[model samples]
Target: MPQKGSRLTPEQVGLIRAWIDQGLQWEEGATFAKAPVLNLSPRRPELPGDEGGHSVDRILASYFARYGVKTSRVGFWIDFLLDACISTRLACCRQ
Candidate 1:
């Protein structure tokens, strides 16, 4: 009594799980490198306007004014720096 154009039910999901458990090896190799690792510094913090409508710049400015340390490249500095690191030629497993 299967309905046409219906979503997968719990039993069907369990069957899929069983199939995966029985040696359903997924293809791997080079697909995992798409996302970049965020090696963030302690100086950078979770900014305001971060999906909660908080102003990141204002918060950073206030913090900088308090500590008297100028905030440079508030938003894009991390990404730009990380991108450079990725593109640079470094030693890779010289063994």
Candidate 2:
């Protein structure tokens, strides 16, 4: 087949055809481009102090006030935990 202004060899064509016949199985973690080096180190973020209730609430107080987003710490944690659980379940199901 013609590729990048050049024709593929007969052997290359045969190999491609065989790959297609075999359901186009790709090698695990295989990539055409170089994968980026990620720093997977644990990080401890500086959270706001318990001056206005929860640390998250204290951090988001200005945001809540600005946007008129009325919510409780209990509600926030429940939603966050539920979302985390669902995400964890989905990830486990995929594996």
Provide the TM-score for each candidate, comma-separated.
0.26, 0.36
Tens digits of per-residue lDDT, candidate 2, 1-95, equal 33568787899989999999999899997878988999999997776655656666777777887899887674478578989999999999999
- TM-score of candidate 1 to 2 decimals: 0.26
| C-alpha-based local distance difference test score of model 1 | 0.66
lDDT assessment of candidate 2: 0.80
| Pairs with steric clashes in candidate 1 | 48-54, 49-54
At residue 55, candidate 2 shows an lDDT of 60
Candidate 1 local lDDT, 39-82, one digit each (tens): 77577656654443225455676677779987555656657776
Instruction: Give me the runs in candidate 2 sitting further than 4 Å from their true place.
Output: 1-36, 49-52, 74-76, 79-95
